[model samples]
Target: MTTEQDSRASDAVQLAETTTQPSSVVARTSTWSVWALFCLSVGALALTALRGTQWIVSDILIVDGLTAVMWVVVTFFSGIVHSYSRRYMAGDRDIERFYARVFGFTLVVMTMTAANHVALLAAAWLAMGLLMAGLIGHVRDWEQAQAAATLARRYFLASSALLAGSLSLLAWATGTTSISGILAQADEISTSVALVAVSAIVLAALIQSALFPFHNWLLSSMTAPTPASALMHAGFVNAGGILLTRFAPVVTLEVAVMSAVVLIGAVSALLGQAMGLVQPNVKRKLGSSTIAQMGFMIMQCGLGFFAAAIAHLILHGFYKAYLFLSAGASVEQTVPKDAKSTDTGVSSVAIGAVTAVGAGVVFATLTGKSLLAFDSGTILVLVVVLTTLTATRDILRRAVLPATLRVAAVPIVVLSAITGYALLYNAISTALSGVPMTDAPTELTAAHFLALALFVVAYLATEFGWHRSSTRLYVFLLNRSQPDSSTVLTTKAEYNDV
Candidate 1:
């Protein structure tokens, strides 16, 4: 080719690139702007919460404890994601589009948290789902990414439809389009209507949170970049807990329903953890873990402690976000290390059990809950104890400490974790004081006991490799844990450069 023609072609390509993607300076500016806005929103929410301000525009918006807490939590996470993405997503051809969608998603979620009108709530829910799907398929040229996005979009759409229908039914029955008003009149609504609406809501929450029988979407969504995945795992999945918490008054109205909720959560939590055990991929492992954590959060809601669910979600968000953003480090293989021995001694188990129980007692005392009470709080305390025990065992077994030091470290580590959790739990409970049924602990029913037994069995089975004893059980879990086929990459040859 002639020199003049080559120069002209290069200039044309540069012009096209300039038109399609924002300059580096412009992209960085937008990133910082969005992050700054989120920071400002957090401060505003904190001030509003501190001043005990509860603002409401009938059937439009409401700013109460629930709203304040969610807004602060969402904005804080969104800001962190934005700041991280600035560097993480650098050099992407569609960086501007990514930022725009993320910004829109964050705004819509914030709006949904404060939405009073059923229509507005439904609209925001739908919009956020679409935006997230777009983010998941940000690499539009990649077939696997496109397939993953389509698969997730279906789940999100189904969730939105269920939520919309539920909200409509509630509005129609209560003769109030306002969520606050509908919940206020929940008791007056007919049993059939309430049941149908809450059932839809439960299903919606399940799909959105990627709880089992509906969890493949999350697994498939690994096609998204790390930052988008972090935002999704951190903020998006928590929407289910937020939804259930927002509808706590109505959800607590039916015993049979709550029992079912607990059962589903238990099954999903166990299954998710079981599936996570078999996953070798780091992101997939994290995805499975998220499913389990969301299930636990839902279980908390089922136990009638929506405030605890909220606190659990907030903590999970921070922890999961960090894990995702730093996931690349997990792939580094500077030196091969020997796997730790799993031969935990009986003494370690005894110490772990004792320390865990003690931590649970401390948590209960700090939170004004009774460990011995035959109520939902008792069940929650038991869960805390079991979780702490598991964590204690892991730490003692993994840490390269002397036997005596390991024994001594159990109480110190477990107690510190429980204490910090209690403080955060108390703060969250206070922040959600205005929400109805935030801590409406119920009497221990047969169903509750059964669910707890199953939970304990699941944990022990996973810990002891008992689940692997049954070939059928292991295969079922492994098969069920897999993402959709189209979303899986079979070979590098499938790549098609833009």
Candidate 2:
């Protein structure tokens, strides 16, 4: 056998041995804790749903529809991650530390979600970032991991600081430290203070979500363990949407501010999709996709559909976690020799597009919204249509079934996806019913339409190979999407400890 083949075989054997070992005591206990928390969260959700009530404690912690839903989603994802990591990191020397940190991070994030006081919320947010940084640098012997951790920590710190300042300003302006109280008095806040506070919030959300200029941290964090990456993508990044949703009242105060957010999200989404297309690494590709998904989530918030944003984040979290955990299995195949047969014909592509459009119309009609009204919901419906079109076309291209079966699959898949999304959206909307400005559909401005136009143009350009014709554009995106220099290895010897 060739040297490369021998090396690959040896690595496979080592992986098998490592993954098959019995879980450590700490791993088992952590797994149990996560599952227990998940169960309790479900019960809490049921109570809230049945009672249709909101609760608060001394203005320090709040329990409402938003809190319950977040608790259920966060704990559910954390439980899955812990279970997966039991086998994935079975024999690592620092297994205990990993589990402990993961559990602590989960707790802190849950606390932040329910925190009613500004200080408690800010503290929890800060702690969440620190723990995630520790997870990224789980391997102390790896220099690259350390660098990645430091880079991520810096971004997280900046986000935390901005969040603190924004909250403080809002509190001072409104003379209230309680989140609900501050939001209730948002109308009394001075215009300058309101704009500044909300602008800082927008920046904080963008940074945490890894949108465009702030995306380097996530790209650089590829050194994190697969489980850590999964958790970060699944729960950590989604905090941006939660933050925006919590502060939706302040966000909708200024038309220009909301427009700015829409513009930022649109740019980030297009750029992220473009960059993900060029990524050669599997994990980094997933990271780029997370950036794009986060962008869409933030865009939903900017468009005034906080419930839709929450639903998108929850769905994206599950999808991403599954992808990360199964990423290893994705590399088992070699390039096929007869790839031409998989190339989709023009007729099939048209059918998929038509199906997606029809689904969008039905979705809009069912929601009792006009397609041309340019409401917040239309953007979401548009996003679904585009996503469905892409998925259906890809299925048509790759499926090895007979022509009849392949064509017939389009409507089934499209309908199922749209139906599922509608259910999730409605559930979230009900959960967020008491929250202010959550489902408030704003009139779209010229800027919003322009951003949509840019999104469509970029999507078409990327999809049709038009962007590939420009070397400079490709090179620019490639460079922008890269991780920090210090986080990349310069020699094989640097990877010896890995």
Candidate 3:
């Protein structure tokens, strides 16, 4: 009798599992559909490139560098996420719905990217938000997922409204609805009109990109499935960068607008990075990282480095997508271990400083470009130098290789990174050469220097406090991240008394 009952229970469990599993045929169909879309988008991108940047079909469609680039990125990543979701969400009852929503969102984003007229762009932008809500709440049974979806929709709605206002102003100023037309008349548009439009665009981009206080929705969105997370971080979050780049001509008209963007972006970057350090969950950590990265990208746009921002957007999209997709394996690799304290000796600090400075000087000399020639070039060199040095130091200190091999590897890695960045930057600059932009104002340059100095000072302070186990700042960050133990204990005691 006991054996019979056990067998029946096992059979019931298996049946439940099978019923919840996604249909193999449905999964295959979804994958193939995305693949077909990807192929079509790629072909369209090539055609657009061949025809040059212009409106097609009577200003109803745009075929420009931004459109071509974004189409390739969105379609490629959509296909990837679709294929990934087939396995990741295999047993999900809503797997079919998830796939449909992802495809729908991708289509809407593509439409937005290809929109020549402001009205079409506005419509597509709003549609993207609606579709995104469905994708975010794919697992509607979860309360957290539903809440995240709601929050995301709220932010997106506000963003859409601001964008609409900007578009209206542009249309009114230019006497035409065409994006190209408005941009062409940027010089003739009254300063007040341009300022209002540019300010609206900046505000819209900030909220859309999840900068600073507006970033909570993005942070809370990790409750979605892995594929959804990947898509959101890699594609959806990049909409602001795309929008700013598309309107570079008009946006660069006002120095004050760019300065505001820079200030907001700098704060977002700093806060995001700090908060990311305290997050215990891997997914949430990545979310914080995305906020920081988007902040930096926006800062680049504000500095009139639209091409550099585009490059950062594409590269970061691919990188963050891979990180999210493989996050499970990463979790396994991150089993808790005893923390080791590394002494930041004067010698080591000196070496790092020298390496960073030397790398920048070498790169500048090799490229035959003056550091002051372009703000983007200067900032890129500083970033690459700092990153390469920091990475080299970390690797060398942790690597188990022979002394000579480790020493050799450092230079090889640093040189390779510098070369790759130089080549990539050059290519992006060439591709976006037609886009009109201006040099950042002197005030903005001063602000950038101030922000950089603060970042460096903060880094040094953190390093100095690393060995102090009782550091107040460290404890505060940790406590803020963790649940309050006192509240939990008090609640338990009260329940016992009751």
Query: How accurate locally is residue 455 in candidate 2, as Cα lDDT from 0 to 100?
Result: 70
In the range 220-312, model 2's lDDT, one tens digit per residue, is 998999999999999999999999999999988988988888888888887888888788789888988998889888888888888888999
User: Would you give me the overall lDDT of model 1?
Assistant: 0.87
Q: Identify the runs in model 3 with alpha carbons over 4 angstroms from their true place.
A: 1-21, 24-26, 47-55, 333-337, 341-347, 358-369, 374-376, 438-444, 465-472, 475-498
lDDT of 3 by residue, 84-168 (tens): 8766787777776777788888889989988889999999999998788777777666555676788788889999999999999
Q: What TM-score, over all chains together, does every model reach?
A: 0.92, 0.93, 0.86
Ranked by lDDT from best down, the candidates are: 1, 2, 3
lDDT (10s digit) by residue, model 1, range 1-498: 999999999999997776555466656666776677667777766877688677898669998888878887887888888878766776688888898888888889989999999999999999999999999999988888999999999999999999999999999999999999998999999999989999999999999999988999999999999999999999999999999999999988888888888888888887888888777789999999999999999998898988889998999999999999999999966676798764358988788889988988898999889866779899888888887877787787777877887778767977997898889989988878777889888777887898889878876886687767888887887888889999988865665343
In order, the Cα lDDT scores of the candidates are 0.87, 0.87, 0.75
Predictions: Cα RMSD each = 3.9, 4.4, 4.7
Top candidate on TM-score is 2
> Ten-residue segment with the worst summed lDDT in candidate 3?
481-490
Residue 262 displacement in candidate 3 (angstroms): 2.0
Please report how far candidate 2 places residue 45 from its true position, in Å: 0.6
TM-score of 3: 0.86
